[model samples]
Target chain A: MSTPYVRRFDSFDRVLHGFLMLSFLGLAATGLPLIFSDQPWARRMTGILGSFEVAGWLHRVCATMLITVFAVHLSRLGRRLIFQRDFGLLWGPRSMVPQPRDLTDAVGHVKWFLGLGARPRFDRYTYWEKFDYWAVFWGMGIIGASGLLLWFPVFFANVVPGWFFNIALLVHGEEALLAVGFIFTMHFFNGHLRPEKFPMDRVIFTGRVSLEELEEERPSEYARLKASGGLAALQVPPPERWLVRLGTVIGTTAVSIGLLLVGFILYAVLT
Target chain B: MRIKHWLAFFSVLFVATLTFVAAKGPTNIPMKAPPAPSRPAVVKAPPEPANDDCLACHGDPDAKSDTGRRIGVDPAKFTESVHGALDLKCVDCHADLKKTTDFPHPSKLAKVNCAGCHQEKVAEYDRSIHAAARRQSAGSVAATCVDCHGTHDIRQKTDPKSLTYPLNLPATCGRCHGDPDVIKQGHIQIGNVSDLYKDSIHGKAVSKSGLMVAANCTSCHGSHDIRKKSDPDSRVFRRNIPNVCGSCHEGIKAQYDNGVHGIANGRGNDKAPVCADCHTAHQIQRADVASWRLDTIRECGTCHADKITTYRDTFHGQVTSLGFVRVAACSDCHGAHDIHGKADPRSTVAPGNIVSTCRKCHPTAGENFAKYDPHADKHDKARNPVLFYAAGFMKWLLLGVFGVFGLHAVLWLPRGFRERRGQAKHS
Candidate 1:
C-alpha cells in the first residue's frame, strides 16, 4: 500500500476556522429576529438589541467576518490546488466512496454496539461524517448567496426584479432551518453527542492525532502514516504556551456557556 | 211653688200635642222627583278606556254596571291577560265612569287614543313622511295602534312574544309586506324587502349594537303613519332629502351642502347626485370589505363608468386581487356619504385636499401624486398610460418571479441534495 500523508492544520488555519464558526454563530443569533419577529419574547430581545436597525448592523458585521474567513480559506485552498497539486485531498480516493462494504461495515458496527461483532473497518472518515461536511458546504453556499442579496436590497433592485425579495426570504428561512437542524441533530451526534465524546471532542482544538486514537479511529490512515514516516512529523506540543492555553480554556468555557444559553432559550421559545 | 205646678201641667199638655202632630205630619207631604236638564239633547256613544289594565275593577261580570263597571269591555278575557297580572284596572283610565255614561263619551277619560297616551312620540311620528302620506292619501294603509299592537293582547315590548320585540318585529311587519297573497290583495308591490334589509349594514348593526337609534323598520318608515313617497309633504321627498338623511348624517350633510352635489339642479344645470344616488336608501352597507366597495364602484359606475374601468386596471386593483386588502377604493379617498364633484371646495377629491384624504389609508402615498385623478379614463385610449403600464409590468414581474423561484425550489432543491450526496460519497 502507498504511504499516506498526515498533515495537521496550521495554527492560523485553526484560529481562522474558529473565528468563522464564531462569526456564523453571531450572524445566526442576530438575524433570527427577522425570522421570529412575531414571538413575544423575541420582541424583548429585539428591543434590547436596539430594534431592527441594530440587529441588521450586527448581522452585517458577522457576515463581513464570514466573508473574510471564506476568502482566506479559498486562497489557502487555491494555493494547495495550484502549488501542492493536492486535488486528491478533495476526492481522497476510490476508497472514500460509500460502497456496499460500508453497509456491511455499518451493520457490523451496529452489531458491535450490541456485542455481536468486532468494530467495523472504518476508513479515514465515516460516511456520516463525510455527508455532514459536504452538507455544510452546500448549505453555506446557498444561504450565503441569498443572504447577500437580502443584505443589499437597493443594490440588487437595479439588477434583480422586486419579486426576488420574496423568494430570497423563503430560501433564507428554509436554509436557516436546515442548517440549524443539521447542526443540532447530525453534527451534535457525530461530533459532540457520542458516548466517547460526550460533551465535546478535543481533536478540533488540538488538530493532532494521537497514536492510539489514530490506530483505533482511522487505522488505515495510521498505517499509511507509519509507512511514510509522517507520523513523527505530526507532533503538536500540546499548546505549551501558557497564555494560549489559558486563553483557550477561557474561550472554550465562554463559548460553551453561550451555546448552552442559546440552546435553552431556543428550547423555551420553540416549546 | 204655684209657678212650678203650673209648668208641670203645661209640659204634660205639650208632650200630648207634639206626639199627635208628629204622627200626622209625614203622611200629609207628597213625594216628587228632582228636575232634569232644561233641554233634553241626544247623547253619543261612550269612548274606549285607555288604562293598561281593563280587568281590575271590571273583572266581575256581575260587577255593578251603574258604578264600577260603567265602561264596558269584555271583562272575562281582560281578567286573564298579562295586564291583569299587574293589577291595573279600568277605572284608572275611565276617570268619570262613575259620574255618567252621557253622550260624547266623557273626554275626561284622557280620550283613550294611543296618541293621547303617547303624545310626544306620536307627535314626532306625525311629522314623518309616513304620517303625511297617510293623511294625504286619506286612509291608504294608514297604520294605527291595532296594526302593530294587538287590540287586547298588546303585551309589553319586553316580551319576546310581543309584535314589537326586536327579534319578532321584522317578521311581524313582513307578514303583510312580505306575504305574496297579502301584497296582492292589498295592491302592494311585492318583494322580500325584509330579507334585503337583513343584508344591509344598518340591519346588522341594529342587531349588533342593540342601539334603538340604529335603523329598524320603524326608523325609516314612520311607525304610526307611514306615507307614500309621491306626497310632497313626505319626509323622503326630494326637497326634504337633506333633513331626512341628515338625522343621522348631520356632519356629512353640512359638508355636502357646500359640495357640488348639493347645488340646485333646476336652473339649467344637470341633476346633482342626491343621497339615494350614491347610497341606495334601504340597501346601505359598510364599505370596508372589497366586495362591498366593488359593489359601490359598480353603483357609481352606472353614472361614471369610465372612471371605474380605469380604477379596476390600477396597481391597487391588482394588489387587491393578491389579497393585500388595505388598498384604495373609491370611498377610501372620496368621503363616503358626503361625496362631491372635484370642483367643490368641500370635496375630498379636490386637488388641495386629496393628499390628506389618501394618507388616511396609504401613509406612504406621495403628496403630489395623490391629487392625480385615478378614475379619469381615457375611456378607450389605454387609460392612465403610465400607471397602467407600470402596474401591469409589476404584476407580471412579481408573478414571473414567484413562478421561477417555485420551479427552482421544486427542481433544483432535490438536484442539489443528490449532488451533495454524490460529493459525500466521493469524500
Candidate 2:
C-alpha cells in the first residue's frame, strides 16, 4: 500500500508559507547588497539588478509582501480566538505556544544529542519549531517597524526627531542582518539540513507528512491523536505525484538560493 | 591797421601784401582750396625681383652659400606656401636684394625684417619671454618665427599641415618644452607640461578625437604674448584661472560665480578654491570617471579638514574609501559647481532643500531621511549624542550575539561528530 499521509498544514497555511519564503528571500537578496555596498560583489549584484535604485525598489516591494503576510497570519490567529472561539490555539499540546513541556523537551533533546539519554517525544510542534515561529514575531516587530520608518521618513519626521532616523537606520540594518543570518543558517539546518531531514523536509510545501514521519517525529501527538480517535480523522491519501514534484522544485530552488546568499553574506563579513 | 593810414601808406601796404603773397607762392591765393592734408609723398615700390631671377641658382638642390651653408630653396615647396599663395615676390621680404641686377647677388644680405609687414605681431612677440631671452645677450636658444612657422613651407594655421594648427600645436610646443636638454639649458621652471596636456581631457579631445574646439597649448597660454603664470596679467595666474577656464566652460563658470567659493575668490580670498585646485592644472580627467569621483572627496577634505573627519565615519565615506562610486560622494548631495553654505537657501544641503538633494540618490528620502547625518561625528557627544549611543549599542549587540551563538555552534560540533559516529556503528 502507498504510504498514508496526515495533513500538517492546510492549503491556506501552505500558500502563506510560500509567500513568506519568497518575500523573505527577496528582501535579503536586495538588502544585503546595500548593507555590504563596499564589497566588489555587492556592486556586481546591484549591477545585475540593473542599479542600486532598482534594488531599493525591489526591497520595498518584498517588504510590503512580508508585512501583508504577517498581518494576514495575525488576523487568522485573531479570528481563531475571537470569532471561532478556539482557545486550544492559545494553550494546548497542539498549540504553537511554548510550555513547561518544551523546556523538558529541549533538555532531553540536548541530552540525547550528547548520547546521555533517550530522545524526547515531540507534540504538534517541537521547542525549536516554536522558537522559529516566535522569532518571526520578534523579527517582524523590529525589522518591519524600523523598515517602515525608513521607508516613510518624511511622514515620520513630523512625529519623531531627526536623529530617530539614524537610530532607525542602525536598528533596521542590524536587525535585518541578524534575521537573515539566523534564518539562512540555523533555521535552514533545523528545517532541512539535519541528518534526519538531510536533503529537505517538504511538509511545509506539500502540506502533508507521511504517516511514518508523523509517528516517528511527533510520537506524543500521534499517541494523543490515536487515543482521542483523531488519528483516523487526520489520515489522508498520499499527496499527488505532481504536487510532490512541485514541492521538490520549489524547495530545492529556495534552499539553493538561501545557501548561496549565505555564502555571499559570509564572504562579505569575513573580508 | 585801418587799411589806409594815408594815401602814401597805401602804396607800401599794397607792396607788403604782394610781397607776402609772393613769399607764400600760389598756395595763399584766396581761390585756392585748403592745401590737402600734408602726407608723406608716396614713392612707388621698386619692381620686385622675379622668382625666376633668384630661383635660377637658389632652387638648385646643390646650391650653397660662399660660407658652405645650404642656400637651396625648393621652388615647388615655396610655390605652395602661404606667402607664395599671396603672390609675394622673392624681393618682398629680401628687400636688400630689390635693386641687385647681378646674376649672382652678394651672399651677405641683410636679415629679412618680418616686422616690415607684421609690425603688430612682431611688437607683441618682442614683449614675450622668448624675445626677452633672445635679447638678454646670454645667447639663450629661444624660438623665433622660423622655429614654429616653416621658413619657405609655412602654411596657414587653418591647414592641417600647419605646425600651429590645433592638433599639431602640442607637438610643436613640445619640441622645446618637452626636450630635457632645452629645459635644462633654458632653466625652464615648468617641466614637460606638454606631456601632462597630452594625457588631459582637452589633449585627448584634440589629438585623439580631432576636436577643433578643444584647448591647445596656445588656447590658455597666448600664442605670441605668453607670460609666466606668476605674472598677474597671465591667463594662468591664480586670480585669472577662472576667467581663463571660463572662456570655454561658460555655464560652469556662471554657476561657480554664484557659489560660495567663487564669491570668496571674488573677494580676494586666496584660500578659496578654483577649478584647478581640485581638478589640477594639467592631467585633468573627466569628472565623471570613477577614480576622479572617488578622489575628489579627499581633495575637498584638504580645506574642510573638520568636515572630512566626520564624513569619513559614515557609510557613504567608508564605501568611497574603498574606491566605489555605488554610493553618494560629497558632490552627489552638495552641488559640484554651485556649492553653497548651508545657511544659504540656494544650497543643496540647506535645511529647506536637503531632502531634495538626498532624493537624487535616495528617491524616497524625506526630511527624516535627510536628517541621517552623513558627516555625523559619533564621538562628539555634545553634537550627536543619539548617534554616539546608537552606534555604541550596535557595536556591543553585534559582538554579544555573535560571541554567544558562535560559542554554541562550536560546542555543538563535537556532539555532532559523536552522533555521526554512533549512527555509523549502529548501522
Candidate 3:
C-alpha cells in the first residue's frame, strides 16, 4: 500500500522558504565578491552584476527581501502563540523548545557520532534543527544591524559615536563570514545533504513527508499525535509531482550555488 | 701732424680689413722689426703683428681699468685658449691698436670681438634671454660670451680648466647670477639658482659622482640658448616639460603624456603641471627617498587641494600623512605615471579597476574592499550613507550578538553536561 503523507510545513512557510532561499543566495552571490574583491575570481565575478553600483543596488534589494521574510515568519509565529493560543507548538512534546530531553538528545547524538551510544530519537524538530532555526535570528540580527549602520551612518550618527563605523565594518564582514560558513556547511549537511536525506529532503520546500519518514525520524511526535487522536488531522495527500519537481529543481540549484560559495569562502580563507 | 694722422688711419684700416676677412684666428707671423733705433732704449719702437708690443704694455701686472681695477692678462693663461692654439697675433683681435698708441690708450679701447670667429655661437647666444635683456636695454647687466668664457684665457670645453666645461657650468653661471651687484641691476633674479641646484638630488649626484654626465646647469636648460620659462620654445616651458623629462625618462614620459596633466597642458592650460610643478626645477628631490616622500603629497596638494584633505582623513591617507611608507598614498592607487581621470576606464580609481589597484596594498581585497573609498569625504552624507551607517550598525549588532549569545552558551553548556551524566547513570 502507498504510504500516507503528513503535512509538516504549511504552504505559507514553503513560499517564505522559497523567497528566503532566493534572497539569501542573491545576497551571497552579489555580496561575497565585494568581501573577496582582491581575488581575481571575485573581481571577474562581480562584473556579472554589471558594475559595483549595480551590485550594491541588488544587494540592498535582496537584503530587504530577506528581512521581510524573517519579519513575516516571526509575526506568523507571534499571531499563533498570542491569538490562537497554540501553546502545543511551543511547549508540548511536539514543540520546538529546549527541553531536558533535548540536552540528553544532543549528548546522545554526539555519542552516536562517536560510536558510543544508540542514536537519539527526535521529535518534530531535533536539537540541531532548533539551533539552525535560531541561528538565522542571530545571524540576521547581527549582520542586518551592522549592515544598516554602514548603510546609513549619518542618520544614526546623531545618536551614536562616529567611531562605531570602524567597529561595524569589522563585525559586518566577520559575522557575515561566520553566518555564511554555518549555513553553507553545518546547516546544509544536517538538514538535507546527510546520507539519509541525499540527494535532498524537500519537506521544507514541499511542506509534506511520507508516513514512514515521520514514523522513523520523528517517532515521538508521531506517537504522541496518534495518542491524542490528532495524527489523522495532520495527514494529507502527497504533494503533486510538479510541485515536488519544482522543489527539486529549485532546491538543487540553491544547494549547488551554496556549495560553490562555500568552496570560494574556503579558498579565500586558505589563500 | 696731418701725415701722422694719415699713417695711423691707413695702418688701422688695413688691419681692420684683414681682421674681418680672416676665416680663422690669425696665424703667427715672424714680424720684420723696424730699423734698430740708436736712440734711448725707452724710445725704441716695436715691430708688426704686435703681440709682444701690445703684451709689453697691456699684459703688465699693473695695467688697469679706468676705475683703477687691475685688468692684467697672464700670458700663460692665454696660451691655453683656442685663439692662442691657432697662434693668433695680438693685432688680429686689436685691429685699431695704431689709434691707441698715444699715452693712456684713449678712454675706450676697441671692444674684444669674440663674434669675429665665433659667429655661429654668437647667433645662438643672441636668441637667449641674456642677449634679449641687453638688446631691450635691461642693462649691460646681461651675460655675454666673454662673461661666461674668459676673453683671452678661454679653453676647450673638454679641458677641466675651461670655464664652459660641464662640471664648471653652475659656478660659471653663478658668477654674475649670484653677484649681488649684478643682481641689483634687475635683469634676472637667478634666485640662488646655483645654491638650490647644489642642494638638489641632481646636485648631490653630480657632486658625489664627480662626473660631467649628471644633470647640471646645462642639462635642463640649454647652454647657448637658455630662455625665460615663459617662452614657448623654452626647455622648461609647461608644454615642453614631459619632453624635457622624457629625454632621460622615456618610459615615464610616455606614461605621463597620456595622463590628465599632460593632456591639460596639451590643451593649452598653462596652470597644468609639468615635471617641475611637482618635482621643482632647481631643487628636484628623488621621490623614493624619505623627506621627499612626504613632500610629494604636499606637492600634489599644490594642484589638488581638497583631494589631499579627503585622502588624509582616510586610514591609508592618515598613516601616510604620519610618514608611514607601508600605507598607500596618492600615487599608489591613482598611479604615478599613468594617472587618469575617474571617468576613464583605465583609471586605477575607477569603479571597475579599483579592486586591482588597491590589491597592491591589500592583497586580499575584493570588489567589496574597493568599495571602501579612499577618497570618501565623511561630510558628504548622500554619497557615503551606505558605508557610513553599515559601520555604525555593526557596532551595536556585535554588542547584542555577544550579549545574548554569550549568555545562551553559558546556560546551555552546563545543562547539557549535567544531563549527559544523568542519562549515563540512568542507563
User: How well does candidate 1 score on lDDT at residue B303?
Assistant: 72
Q: Tens digit of lDDT per residue, candidate 1, span A1-271?
A: 3233233556688788688677767776765545554455555666688655676688889888888887787798789879988775566522334556566765675565555656665666666566566566666787788788776654565566544544455466556655654555446545654444445555555565456656866776677767879777875455335644654674566456455535644665677
Q: What is the interface RMSD of candidate 3, in Å?
A: 12.5
Give lDDT tens digits, candidate 2, residues B1-427. Answer: 2332243234434444554567656543222221211111122344335667688789886788879999999888887888776545577678788777776887788987777767777888887878877888567878888778878888888889899988998889999988998888788887888789899999999989999999898888888878778878778888788998999999999999999989988888989888898788877899888888877888999898988877765557755655567788888888888999989999998899988888887777666567678777767788888877877887787677566545545545566666657667977
Off by over 4 Å in 2: B1-148, B155-162, B165-214, B221-243, B246-273, B277-329, B337-372, B377-380, B417-427
State in Å the error of residue A118, model 1.
3.8
RMSD of each: 19.1, 11.8, 18.1
lDDT of each: 0.57, 0.80, 0.72
Error of 3 at B322 (Å): 3.1
TM-score per model over all chains: 0.40, 0.70, 0.50
Q: What is the TM-score of chain B alone in each candidate?
A: 0.53, 0.76, 0.74
Candidate 2 matches the true fold with a TM-score of: 0.70
Model 1, B117-165: lDDT tens digits are 4566577667754455467776456455566766545666667767777
The lDDT-based order of candidates, best leading, equals 2, 3, 1
Better of 2 and 3 by lDDT: 2
The alpha-carbon lDDT assigned to residue B315 of candidate 1 equals: 35
